[model samples]
Target: MTVLGEPRTADERRTPDRRGAVDGGAWRARARRWWPAAWGAVLGAVLFAVAHRAMPDDALISLSFARNLAEHGQWALTTGIEVHTATSPLNIWLLAALHLLTGGHAFLAAGALLAITLAATALWLRDLGGDRVALLGTALLASSPLLGSAVGLETYLAVAVLVGLVRYAADGRWLPAGVLLGAAVLTRPDLLAAALVALLVLLPGAPRLWRALPVGLAVALPWHLFAWWRFGSAWPHTVPIKGNGRGWFDGSFYLWNSWPDFFLVSFTGVTVVALATAAGGLAGAAWSLWTRRWVPVALAAGAVVHFAALGLSHAPPMMYYAGPPIGALAVALVLAADTVRWGWIVPAGLVAAGVAVSVLHGPGWADGLAPVRQNWATNPEYEAIARDLPTDGVVYSSTEIGALAFYCQDRGCTVVDGVLADPGRVDQRWVAPWRAERPWTALNYRHYRPPAPIPARWRLEMGPAEPRPGDWPITRAPGVHQVARLVPEG
Candidate 1:
């Protein structure tokens, strides 16, 4: 017979706020103090999801292929499923590992890895800077749209390794830092610059350089050895495989145009305020460098070198590669906002608002999931084409053709060429179709010059060639057949 209106006491009463929890006025104070860091982390998660959601079909398909290869043991190395190009295997490995851990859910595994990377990145930033600076840096990184697009990609993997190296260096942990850089080298040879940076930053004061170097070398040796064994070269990861030299100036078009658009898309949908804050921080950092301030100078120098290395590449680096610089920019902004005219808090509300908007928008971003989101069963055409084929069947296709091979491999389907499997194979295949049209070389395309004869052993298949009136003679060639036509399953 308890009274209906009476408030409960002791055991029935709401537990007193925990010792760590803030109450009433104290809650407001804590909120004011911690809001920036919390908002930054939230914003980062949103932008990260957006980029991951919008990944192109080709890239997602490659990742799916890599996962399938590892699950089925088609390839020894975690190399991507396509004719293997020179991209680092770490990104694929990450995806594969996630798939393995999660019982083969490709999209879930990738999404998990992407989330983990974002979280690790924020934690790494916090370790590099203090909590406040880390929060600000993470806010700048997570809210920017580019982060989502690049997460789980090679560029993001490189950046994550680089961030790990920087954190280890900052903590005076030379061996761990070196090991991270070594992994960076395995993943992307261009990260040699970061390795150099780590050495410069970590070695001078290390008490036992010999001991630390070996520790790092030991961890990285297996991958190095494996690369040598597989590719017949120590630096099998470079771009020269495509006849493109090691000169850094080859890929300017990608760096300038594609990267910015990537960033704009990744950022606009999430923490828009972070962009302004990052810009302000970049400007401030530049000013600090001009004034010869040591801390800002160090960060800016590292960032400039990083940006320059990426800029020199023939392929434009992904937006996540910009994380470290963005983090550094966060440190700069925090410093400027707090110490420089007390203007640091200006963007804080905008960051929070942006985060709120992203969260409120919920899961609609799933609409953007493309080839990455669907598994083999969803793509019946590839499976139908590959059905009952030999595991080692010499089929020619793009880097993502592994998606088909994943299912066909059980039937002994052997893919002779894929974009990511072996660069040499892909290059050879590119010339094969042209050569197939000739008499001795009878290229498969039949569109080549000199009226080359078709190959006797090879079958000619045309995939939905658009109407071109002048090409009727070539289209009407004997033995020509339409093998398959793919329409969006959606």
Candidate 2:
């Protein structure tokens, strides 16, 4: 009814640049601002599917906690007794919220969380670095087999929070940065060192930064306080279970994880990978400092600080713990690019080696899914054992309890002979805090373990030398595994 060239009245149509009506430019602008995140989401969703297939047995531990928390209003994996085995409060809570909101399983919740966080991470990285660098960083994260293996865990969430913290801190937005800093700690307390290092490096002369500390503490304090009040400790039960053991998070361990297994395993391989890594890091740090590329430098500093802290403390370096630092290092390396002169050689060599190894590493990195390594076991196999377990009796599993408890539909029913479920340590004192007060008789500690008497009705171990009847094949692993039934000790 209107002429094509005529101007429209206020009641009619608005111009493209105006705020009133549907505008193509606005949508284009939004799409431009968000395309990187879409790329990241696609990458994340694909990887999550892969990880879900081979989801580690340990990862299901937290998934179960989340499921039980959502369904039962209790923090315990098993019923009755409340335990603090979940190391990441934020991870479980996020999973719980996702589970409740969508009425889906915990793994589904985890996959959704992974995609969202990675998308957020990509957008932040875009803001911190330019589009090309951001995409590279995202690729590095999405391609890592280690992160793929760490699905259903806090690593994805913490990395996203860490990236946001770095982004805000670099942009001089102290308040939001502080909030993310606290979230990082809550997600993975070990990230504290990384946060401090990033802040110190990024804020050499920034003013009014003191407010960030108080805000961060405010955000993170209440949970620790509540935990201490209820669980008799401020940290997760895992701190005692695996903390202070040596060689877990050290340089050799990091190197081993960074490269493909065939590329580096022996002492010579470890040494070469370590040296190459150190050289690449130093070059990146130098270039970042010289060019005032604050994010890359901050990222590198975080990796160094975390590795040093864990290594110096002789902390047990579990494989799952490598994600954040390794991820940070990867981002830094990709962002650093070529330095002036001969310095480019180091980063180039590093990049070349990593890419070559990854290309040869197979579909794990290619499809952006979890790697099926030689020895470790994963989801379905563990779930099979868990379903096979009798919930009526105390099924004592010494090796893999996480997937078992989750599948057994936890109720404090399946107790392992491990310190992870030390029943009621309300008044307990550590004899040797480093080793989790293990070796009770000689260590002079009485932190009570859920006792499993010998010759019980069910004994689940790592299994016999070879497969026999009643043996369950851990599809992810090449070994004998079968639950044995014995005469009741009573």
Candidate 3:
């Protein structure tokens, strides 16, 4: 009559002991509840590792800063120069720590750090939404070529911190939320707008609001003070350089072209999933507004801030810019799924199909591995140039400054960034060159050569030089003097 310390009735005995059946059913339900998120976390880590293998040139710039910090005790893009050019101070610090731990393997360290961050984010998403929405969101992000391409950047880490801040704020943990928001700002200064939105969400209670404000300021103030003291500004020189001369129409054009181009050109199934998730996010925002749910409202507001800031800025709408928007879409989809339980299935299936296609017919793991090989094999030219230069020579490169500086770090040649190091010193004529060439744009200014004559022992130019057997062509435009030789006297 007793089964596992519980009394069993005669009816149960007649029913052949339903307790085991009940326990089995409960176990199955628990598995259903937890399995998708666990699987999603694993998948996210794998995808992030693959995507991060091909480190972007910008990431290399950050790595150079990290390397300098680790090896030479300098917080600059180029060692021995004390400059506040790092956009993400926390990211640089973290990468520097990783570099130290990994014996200076910046790329591998970045990949590992990114994978862990992304996996943890996926798990946290599951706690916010159920397993289905978590899986769906994680799959969509993992399948995105752009998101993957941005692995070495701070995009994912910033988003992970944003999600954490929202969760803490929703739980009324004001101080922790504010601290995380501040950390997000350190990761990406543009998220300051999102931090403001979060503050608004916590404003209903005066005590909580007051507590969060000081905590956030406390975390963010040190870096600002240091930057202001060191650089005379709390912002990097890149901001002014990039912000100058931006057309009114450039932002609008960038916004219009970004999402559409990605969807049209990227894998079809993933695009469908993205579109559906975005629709879900819009609907969820409306629903949250109607219901007066503060968490979803704050998240939607943060997404709006991110999109508006990037869209209105002088920066081009690259794929990584979509990271915050995609995060908002995932949260909105999760909220929407809570109301209509089965509605997540369609998008989930699209994401699953996208993953399947990527594995079966796409590059799959090769995408991540190719970058390591390419970076190893392709930078030989830079090394050769560095080898050819004298010990006291200076090399000025326009576009590949990060790669070139990295290669020439210990070659006794001083590397100066032609564009970003000091834009104020750049001659406007070199940036806006005249003669028979293509129309100029804002990006051209970032790669402009200096018009000043070289007064150094030696100066080597490594851009589009005179067409030679192995010379890299900087541009294909005919009659464009893409030669990298001695600077002629003006």
| TM-score winner | 2
lDDT tens string, model 3, 1-490?
Answer: 1111122345743442254446576566566445654665576568655554354556767888888999999876756655555778888888889989999887767866775666666665655554555666666666654455566667777777876776566555678777987898898877777767755764673336557777988999888777666555565555544444243234354543555653445434445555665676777767767765555566777777777776655555444556666666666556555556576675566466556555553453343322112122123344455555555555555435565566667677666655544333333422233211325333323333334433444444444545665343332122233534433222
Candidate 3: where are CA atoms >4 Å away?
Answer: 1-41, 205-207, 245-277, 353-392, 410-414, 422-466, 473-490
lDDT of 2 by residue, 37-95 (tens): 99889888987765576666657778877887889888876544477667788888999
**lDDT computed for candidate 2:** 0.63
| CA RMSD, predictions in order | 13.3, 8.7, 10.1
What root-mean-square deviation over C-alphas does model 1 reach?
13.3
- By lDDT, the best candidate is 2
**Candidates by TM-score, descending order:** 2, 3, 1
Better of 1 and 3 by TM-score: 3
> Where in model 1 is the C-alpha error above 4 Å?
1-52, 57-62, 74-86, 198-215, 241-281, 287-299, 316-365, 369-418, 422-424, 427-490
TM-score of each: 0.60, 0.78, 0.73
lDDT of 2 at 233: 56
- Native-vs-model 3 lDDT? 0.59
lDDT of 1 by residue, 79-144 (tens): 233233435666677777788888887766766765566566556554444455456555645544
Q: 133 in model 3: Cα distance from truth in Å?
A: 4.0
10 residues in a row with least lDDT, candidate 2: 1-10
